[model samples]
Every structure is written in structure tokens, then in C-alpha cells.
Target chain A: MDRIPILRMGDFLLVTIQVDMHDQLAMTLQDDLTSQIEKTGAKGVLIDISALEMVDSFIGRMIANISGMSRILDASTVVVGMQPAVAITLVELGLSLAGVQTALNVDRGMQRLRADVAGKEADDGRHQE
Target chain B: MAVTKSEVIPIRTEHDIVVARQAVRRLSVEAAFGLVDQTKMVTAASELARNTFIYGGGGTLQCESLLEGARRGLRLTFTDQGPGIADLSLAMKDGWTSGSGMGLGLSGAKRLVNEFEIESVHGQGTRVTITRWK
Candidate 1:
């Protein structure tokens, strides 16, 4: 019954992974995140992984799946706060997380999301006019 | 060189994979490996533990702490009685997976450690050994 909480902050959903997630927990988070995005109509997702010391291929793939699903649902995902060691291990593990965007920290991630949403809205307004 | 200390852990389910990672991390830290080295070892352990559970059906992990001369190292040996791999050369290739995984488990784990070895018998089982020296 352990679940990672998904917090909605205005137009974005913020997920801070603080535990050493097992495979089931990672899968559940993916499902919960997509459902939350649909229900809230969020435009962006920011995943904080600073607290995670290790990231294996399974967890890396889960992040990619979440990003891809969010993209299809009209949302952008930014993975932030990856530890230097974790990043090195991920690259060595051959999981580049191809389609997902990353930032140095949560503050920068939020700024990036805000700008992305604002840009999308501007494009939409132009199309309407 | 002989291992100064060793412990054996079972890999039966998903939860065991997490435990395996923690054990590897602890051993790597105790060996005085840097943060990057510890993370690499732990990540490799996670991949192998999952492989043991999902592909091998179940297995045992032996973690050993080694002291060779002035160098310290951590070594892990995973053995499973499941159906053995028929094509080791192909399995070691990147992006080659018999399961739903990204196929990076074997090759990726190899890249993370300083030494890697694998043995399999067609009908018997598989054994993988890896070591990282600090």
C-alpha cells in the first residue's frame, strides 16, 4: 500500500521520489502520474530524484515511460535533481533517458516548465487568432 | 587473494532487489570506494538481482569484501538454477534481451565493474561474478 504521492502545483504535477523504489512502486508511480495528469489537465511534470542514490535500468525506463506518456497526454516532463553519481551510473547503464528533459535542480526545473507552458499557450493563442 | 568477509542473500522477489542494492552499497562504502564507484556497483547489483528473480526464477547472491595488498574491493556472485542462456555471445551484446527489459542488464553490469565473468550450462544453471576494486 506504499505509494509515492503526486502533488499538483498549478499547471504542473510535482513528484519527488524519496525512497529506494522497488519495481512495483515504480510502476505504480507511473500509473498514478498519468491518471493525475489526465484528471488535473496538467501541462507539465517535474520529477525530483535527488534523494535517490541508485538508478537501475528498470527505474530509468520507468522515467522514460512516464515522460513519453505525459507527452502524449499534452504535458512536458522535466527530471530534476539527479545526483552526480546517479547520473554517471545511468549513463554507464546505457540508459540515456532519450526523450526526457533534465535540470540541475527543482528551482531550475520549475522555471523551465513555466517557460514551456507559456510558450505553448502563446502558440495556441496565435493559432486561434 | 581470499575474501576477508562475505555474506549470502536470497533473490526471490522484487523486494529482494532493493535489499541487494542496499547490501552492495554498504559493501562498496566499506571498501572505501568513492560515491560514483558505490553507485555503479549498486546499480549493477540491482540489474543482476532483477535478472535473477525474473529470468532465473530465483537465485542466491554472494557478496564478498576483499583486501588485496593495499587495494580493497567488493565482489558479487549471482547463481541461479533456472534455464541457462544458450547464446552467451549474443546475450552479452547491447540491446539483446530475452525478457521485457531494455537488455542492458548483462552488458551494462559489465561496464560498471572492474572485473566480470559468466558461466552457464545448457540445462543446469547460470553464474555471474563481478568485482570492483578501490
Candidate 2:
């Protein structure tokens, strides 16, 4: 069984999609990512899709599902490194990947995630006070 | 215009969809399609291949590289011998899926290409054809 590895960096989970994902593989990734988020209690997830040449409706939905699931598990997801062509295709496919934050690269994605976590922490502190 | 070169690939499972997408990408590039055009064609092929596998119970893809006058293009036809769609108009409507998908395959694929055609007969089979010109 081929699996996409999920790496952890500090409070964030990193997944770099390098292969052309099949349906089963994409489902597995969704499952693995959600479970990993639970086990690590990560604050954010960064998925680097720069290597993916195409993302159809199915994959687009999977990305949205991952982001939604992460949100429910007390984490944020940022999809980064989308190619211009992929973006165009996704829009044409009628999938905007709404509700999922995006960035140009991994570094910027990480920064956004950190800021998100910090904002949440601030809100939590204010509530406790 | 006649198809210059054509290849047929079977779509039985998920792996076949990936292969079909790669084939579309290769043919589009060979036909001198731009990056956005290649991506759109590959994405459209992938969507149709999934539809063939999931809804049509497997099918075959006919990929053709076209040269008409000074214009070049890539065309693909997906045919399946499964239960055909009952309502094509509904199927082509966005957010109307017969399965668990987001219901964007047919309509979205149509938006990606320059030419789109679909023919289906209930209890018989279905065929979808698309072409993107460069």
C-alpha cells in the first residue's frame, strides 16, 4: 500500500504531495492526516501541492474535506504551492476550494499557520481572563 | 478534421485514471498546447475517467492528437458499457451528482475544453467526447 508521509514540524503537520494521487491514495491521506492531527494535537497543517500537475474535482473535494476535518479537530489547514495551471483547471472544474487558506509557498504557509495559532491563543487568553 | 494519431486506454480502476491524465498531458504538450491548456485538458480527462470508472462501471478512453489547418489540438473520447445516465441535462447541471462526488465532473469538464459532446442511452452505455484547441 502506497502512502503519503505526513511530517510534523513543531506544532504543524506538513504533507508534500509529490505523486499523482489516485482515489484510494487520496482517501488514505485524508484518513491519515485527520488521525495524525488527533494524535499530535497539531495547531496547523500545511499541504504543499507544487508538484501536483493537476487536481480534478475529486482531489479538490478531498483537500476541502481535509481542511474541514482539521478545523473540527482544533487545527487549521493551509494549502500552498498551487501551480497557475492547476488553479485555472480547478476554477474551470467549478471547485474553488472555499474555506481553505492558501499561500504561495511553504514558508509563507507556515507563517500564516503560526499567526493563526497565535491569534487563537490570544483569544483563548482573553476568554480565560 | 481527421485525427492525426490516436491511442486507446482502458479505465478499470483508479490507476487507469492517473494513466489517462498523464497521457492527456503528454498529448497536449506534444500538440504545442500552453501550460494552462495542458492542465485544463489533463484535468478534464481525469474527471471523465473517474466518471467512467465510478458511474459507468469501467470504460475506454480514445486519445487523439489533432492537426487541422494551422491549429493543433487534443481530443479525448470516453466510452462506457454500463448503465447510462437517465437525465443528461441534470447530469450536466453543476452540483447535481448521482454519486458521492461534488457533481462537477461533467459540467466542469465541459468548461475546460473548447468542444464537448455527450451521448447516453438508458440501460445501454454512455460516451463523452471533448476537444481543446491550441
Candidate 3:
């Protein structure tokens, strides 16, 4: 089974989706990402979809699921680098991606992920978690 | 309503869905579809292709490059011989799913294309056709 790699970087995990993922591939990614966050206790996840030319409902729902799942596991997920055309088609497809955080580029996504994780950690530390 | 080029791809598995999208994109580009048009066509193809596979069991995607007057367009037809949809209106409603999906496949694909049409027999099969003009 071909799998998308999940890279670990300090307190964060980075994934760059570079292919037009099939339904199975996308499902595998959803499972792999949640488990990786749980095992590594990662504080954040950054997904770069710049290489993907299309993101239909299947893929879009996977992104939203990843974010929601990561939140329950005490992590933040930021998706970045969506092409303008892909974004336009996504809305027209009726998938507004509500509740999913996004950024224009990977750099910004990383920054947002870092800040979100840092803020959460500070609040937790003060509460003795 | 003249097809300048055409091809057929069998949609038997998830990977076939990816192939369908790529095929639609190639034909759309050859027909001089703009970037956004190509994206819309390809995305719509993805949605319909998956429906043809998952809900329809297995099927085929027919890609056509059309020349109607001065407009060049791409048309895709998905056909399957699975247990067809019983209630199409309810199925087309947003956020309604048979089991495991966002339930946006039919309605969403309709919105992304210039033309959409669907026909199904309760116990026979389903066919969805869509076109995007460039």
C-alpha cells in the first residue's frame, strides 16, 4: 500500500500532499495522521497541499476530520498552500471548509501552528497540566 | 454537439477515480479550458467518478471533447450497473448520505459544471452526465 509520509519536526508534524490522492489514500492519511499525533504527542500539524491541483469533497472532508480529530487529541492542524483555482472550486462545490484553519503558504501555516501550540501550552502549564 | 476526441476509462477501484480525474483534466486542457475551468471539470469528475465506484459498485467514465460552434467543452458520463438510487431528489439534497460520505457528491458536482443531468432506475443502474464549456 503506497502511503503518504508523515514527517516529525520537534513538536510538530509536517505533511506535503503532492499527488491527486484517491479515496483510499486519503482515508489512510486521515488514520495515519491521527495516530501519529497521538503516539508522538505532537503539538501541531502542518499540511501543504500546494502540489495538489484538485481537492474534491472526499479530500476536503478528510482535511476537516484531521483538524477536528487533532483538536480532541490536544494538537493543532493548519492547512496551507491551496491554489486559487482549487479554492474557488471548493466553495462552489458547497464545501466551505468551515472550522478548518488555513493559510496562504506553508511558512505562514507553520507560524500559525507554532503560535497556537505555544498559546495552548502556556495555558496548560499555568493550570498544571 | 460534435465530439472531436473521446476515450473511456473503467472505474473499478479508488485508483481508477484518480485516473478519471487526470483523464478529464487532460481533455479539458486540450479543449483550451482555462485554469479555473479545468479545475472545476476535474473536481466534478472526481466527485462523479467516486459515486460511480462506491455507490454504483463499478462503472466507467466516458470523456469527450466537444466542439459546439466556437465553444470547446469537456463532457463526462458516468455509468454503473449497481443498485440504483431509489429517491434521487432526497439523494441530491445537501448533507444526505446513503452511509459513508458527505452527501455532496451529486449536488456538488452539479454546481461545478455548466450542465448536469442524472438518470437512474431503482433496481437497475445510474448515469450522470456533466459538461464544462471553455
Candidate 1 chain A: 10-residue stretch with minimal lDDT: A90-99
Computed on C-alphas against the true complex, the DockQ of each candidate is: 0.95, 0.95, 0.94
Residue B94, candidate 2: alpha-carbon lDDT? 95
Taking the tens digit of each residue's C-alpha lDDT, what string does model 3 give over A40-129? 999999999999999999999999999999999989999999999999999999999998999999989989998998898799899995
User: Which residue pairs does candidate 1 place in steric collision?
Assistant: none
| Better candidate by lDDT, 2 or 3 | 2
CAPRI-style class, candidate 3: high
- For model 2, residues B52-77, the per-residue Cα lDDT tens digits are 99999999999988889989988899
Provide chain B's TM-score, model 2. 0.98
What are the lDDT figures for the candidates, one per model?
0.95, 0.95, 0.93
Candidate ranking under DockQ, highest first, comes to: 1, 2, 3
RMSD (CA, Å), candidate 3 to true, equals 1.3
Give the range where candidate 1 chain B is weakest over 10 consecutive residues by summed lDDT: B118-127
